[model samples]
Target: KKRYKAQPIVLAIPRGGVVVGYQVAKELGCPLDIIVPRKIGAPHDPEYAIGAVAQDGSMVLDQKVVKSLGISSSYLEEAKKREIEEIERRMKMYRKNLSEPQIVGKTAIIVDDGIATGSTIKAAILSVKKKNPALLVVAVPVGAPDSIAAIKTLIYDIVVLATSYSFAAGGQFSQNLVQTSDQEVIGLLQKASGPQ
Candidate 1:
């Protein structure tokens, strides 16, 4: 983001995004901060993402998917409650005692490992927007073609390394992708900020 090279801000969607964000922030010489949002999965399809919730009780639903799946309002509401609880739990664990970043009037870049449904990134962008950033740029190493395309309309700018329209799982692009542990995320955050 040389356009704002004198100063820039990097926000990484945590868990998966942390790794990608680490590299981006390191390259940009900006401090890294995580925006953790839990995906509210479809009933009986936990791996599939239908929506997501931010730490501050912000939630976004996938109306098209919900309608296609015929999920009831109650079911959606219940899912939101569960995800909000998770948001709270994670906020307390990962964010306690840590002051949140100030994005107002600053160029911000949100990073993630990849965009699958774009729900999580949407949530992250919406949450960041509330902070009134001067500009918001999204960066991801790899993402599905549709997902990458869909996300560009939501943010001011987006940088995606691979938009191979072939369509496959996010991990398919990686040589050795493994489930990341919570311990690893905590370690990365601690390392980013000295002694906090």
Candidate 2:
């Protein structure tokens, strides 16, 4: 509150992030939006993310993991293409007629339920950086200590409520890890927008 005099916009990484972001935006009386970044999972294990692609086609990849896994360029390209398509679909579904949030002179808080590998959130941060917000802050309820430290190198301003050494996944820290639906995201955005 002391850092920012004007209202800061909260950009959540859906679908779980939206739920967390909604509460944050509501409490702060700020606008809530979504930054859709699809994870590029490993070929063998789809749940294991090797990289992520943001809405603007920008990506963040674990080069070591990509190379060590012998992920071919063709496979990466295919995966990126599919993820981009999904990103487009999600943007259309979530934003609908809403214009992109103007964050040039405002603080942009990128909220997420938690950070595991930090690939997807990194992509989201990169995508938001293009818009040139006055300040970019990464806020999450919980995160891996190493992952949080990695993100700290990119942006110094970040807030993580808890850090776990045994962090297996984000869901482990949360009481409710249910999958958030697209409809729920839309409703939250609408509610945050407040009758617009």
TM-score, each model?
Answer: 0.89, 0.94
Over the stretch 1-196, how does candidate 1's per-residue lDDT look in tens digits? Answer: 5777335678887677888887788787787788877788889897787788776657778889989999898987788788778777776676556677778888889988888778888888888889888888999888887888788887788988877665354667764887666677667766777642
- For model 1 the local lDDT of residue 179 reads 67
Regions of candidate 2 where Cα sits further than 4 Å from its true position: 175-177
lDDT of all predictions = 0.78, 0.88
Best-performing candidate as measured by TM-score:
2
lDDT of 2 by residue, 1-196 (tens): 5677655999999888999999988888788988999999999999888999997888999999999999998999899999999998988999888888898878899999899889999999899999888888999999999999999887739999999987766767765656889899998988888753
Clash statistics: count for each candidate = 0, 0
